[model samples]
Target: METQLGNGPAGIRGDLSATDLAKALRQGWRDFAARPQYGLFFASFYVAVGIGLYYLFMVRGETRWLIAAVAGFPLFAPFAAVGLYEVSRRLEQGLPMGWTHVLGALRGRGDEQLLLMGGIIFVGFSFWVIIAHMIFAIFASAAGLGEGMAFLTSQMGLTMLAVGGAIGAIIAFIFYAMTVMSLPMLVDRDVDFITAIITSFKALSANFAVLLLWAVMIAVALFAAILPYFLGLLVVLPVLGHATWHLYRRTVG
Candidate 1:
């Protein structure tokens, strides 16, 4: 089945389906494979962050904080892909993919739209962290636990997971709906962040099922990639990042 072709608020978007997703994945792989260096360059940043998190978890012993921080990666990951988006965009448009051009993804067309979108994501993520900490405090105090994650396997831990995860997922999904299209759109076009966000919402509304599937795929892949000390992100993040750009191109223009 397909989302019926129609006019979107942004005058982009069309029929979206499983086939479109597969094609976008293929395109994403193609883009990354063709220019693995750029993908590697951008993904390295995540690898570094992940390594830093691992250090904090093992050395600094910030287990609870690490848990919350790890959960917040998805919120931050999309913006990191802006550079990947630039790479994918350049490849799609047949433009020169040089360091100066690709590295300047933040400056995107001399407009601040990308940065504005980033600010929205940052603020949302910060609030999410605060809520996560509060939830942790409540759960930890009631359970009488310390910084260690020993309670994670207990009944109270399970309950806290359920409550915190549900709340975290809702907040994450709201931001996902906002950024899924807008970030790429901001990179490809010079539109304001608000317009891009509205268009992103409309795109998600029109292709709810397919987009949801993609989101699940990304989340699963990211979590899996984290298992190997974040080294796996070198491959997963770039491939997924490029795939996201192609997905945006197909569904959101």
Candidate 2:
């Protein structure tokens, strides 16, 4: 027999079964609205820490922006896991969320999963950085040549600009395909890392348009969140985070 929705291994088993996209979307919002305080608490913590770091960096000028970006990963690592744990706790217990419950979920497998996910994140990030630098180097070298095909192309830099954009788009798609469902799948199941990644890629490929929509939405949310030193994330983060869980449910559960 097919498993009952929430009782299944990994909080999901088969393909997307729900047909009401609008209803599913509404449910995601409603689930988050039902407990706004918990959402605010989780997001506030992120904002506070993020702001504190930003202030320190601005005032001290001790680290360049690039160095700050690299150095800050470990500090924000716990919040990343906290976000996942919040989703898992709600999935497993159906309990009304609280800050304490969020923290509790972060214990045990929470940390392990975070570490594993972090490793995956680091590898992907490094790959993107390398590719980006290579792109920059190629364009910079071309621009340095004084007069010739190099100068002609450099004068109408649109070609290089188009190439850069194409490269970025391809990389973004790959990144999304690899990670779209992997974390939730990991939280919901005992699947090995390789399987989770493969499944995530499959989900991304299968639902390319919808996943791209989701990806764009996330980017917008993040931009708004950080625009005001993360205060906006107090609303955007939980809504998007919870909705993401629901999206995973629809696509893979």
Candidate 3:
């Protein structure tokens, strides 16, 4: 059965244009420039964690951990974005920015709505990890593949990658539809997480074409950013994070 939309602080969803994507990027760049300190500060956390994960998996030769990290990291990205939402909110409202305010936004009024959203992200990530492991086991076992670099070169490994990538894309789209506006909505209003998610989904359905393009742009940009040992995320994460706020603003009215 289809679930009904929640009675939250709903708004009319605006039609998104390709030009709006460009405008959002420009505005996001402006926000980052106006407050590079906050952008850099928040970005540093993501870079540090990413680098730490790299060192653990690459340097320490913990490939299993790397698999889990790679599978799960994107799920947590929306939560990390709360900081950027706060920055954009402050910028839009002409509110004063500071360490106290930015950090306090992370506290989120001790709101359980954020916690509920977080739990959903966690569960989604956990499910992906399990599925990834299963795919690996099944394909590798069938092809008599061994661990380390050998599996990567084997036919089984290629098949696993193809299948996993397809599944991961589906999962990513689901999460994106649920979160593309929900997090910012939660931060900007008093709505519950369920309502925010439903609203986000509605917005996506209303403008699936343009929003899908935006999603593709985000994925490509992020992939390019991470290729540089995660250092690029110091900039890419902030820009995209802020842009996401602008996107949410335009989409949700």
Candidate 4:
């Protein structure tokens, strides 16, 4: 069993050796694969969501409706939190990582995790909305109030789009860092939400470069996996999600 200590608000501070981290990550994948059902469940959920969205975009082709559908992405975070918690629980409890464990986590903390996930989704999505509004206001001001952004074009237009993407990326990074370890930590410890968030940030700050590498790897893998029939996500999503559980364990404690 993994050792649990009495480290309060103070979290794991020192850096982990790259070799050790790598080993943990590899082991995580092994354990994850050993329990294929967990991966399948995650993958199936992701594929269903992706297929639904693609159907909306490709078949329906309604931009407004698509945008509305996009709004639901935030809602997924709550349900995902349960999976994240389950992965951690299995790891900490020395239980066989399987479908039973995943379902058990959902059954046990379904309500609480959903509530926490809902809170996280609201705050994160609200931040996105605010930032988007700011971008809109800035664009509107430059193009003259009440007038559309017809003037934004060519190099300048692309630049604005790039800037917007950068802003979104930054938001993503912040949220990823904030929640990466926090969710699993919450499952493993009797800690409050605020502390979990704070500790997550600290872990991210401590391991920014490596975490960034992990994020890039995940993004690239996911992008490639989804390229051929979004159904591919059925395999990719679970691997990455389970891999993430391992990454957090290795990188943090």
**TM per candidate:** 0.93, 0.64, 0.91, 0.71
Tens-place lDDT per residue, model 4, 59-174, is: 75443233333433433432464574577457656877656666666544444643574477567766775665566446645655322234345344445556766776676666
Q: Ranking by TM-score, best first?
A: 1, 3, 4, 2
Query: Cα lDDT of all candidates, in order?
Result: 0.84, 0.58, 0.82, 0.58
Error of 4 at 142 (Å): 11
- For candidate 4, the per-residue lDDT at 134 reads 62
State which candidate has the highest TM-score: 1
Off by over 4 Å in 2: 1-25, 60-101, 107-111, 126-172
Expressed as tens digits, the lDDT of each residue in 1-253 for candidate 1 is 3333455444556458889889988888898999999989888988898789778777987666777888887798889899999998888788987999988987767777887778888999889888888888788789987657687777788788899899988998898899898888888887888988988898998888889988888888889999888888999889888988998888865
120-237 per-residue lDDT for model 2 (tens digits) = 6767656655665465456656677532344335653445546655765576556566666776666666666577778787666565655676667666557666778678878777
lDDT score, residue 92, model 3? Answer: 97
Error of 2 at 251 (Å): 1.1
Clash-forming residue pairs, model 2: 10-188
Candidate 4 structure lDDT: 0.58
Pitting candidate 3 against candidate 4, the one with the higher lDDT is 3
Clash number for each model? 0, 1, 0, 0
Among all windows of ten consecutive residues in candidate 4, which has the lowest summed lDDT?
A: 2-11
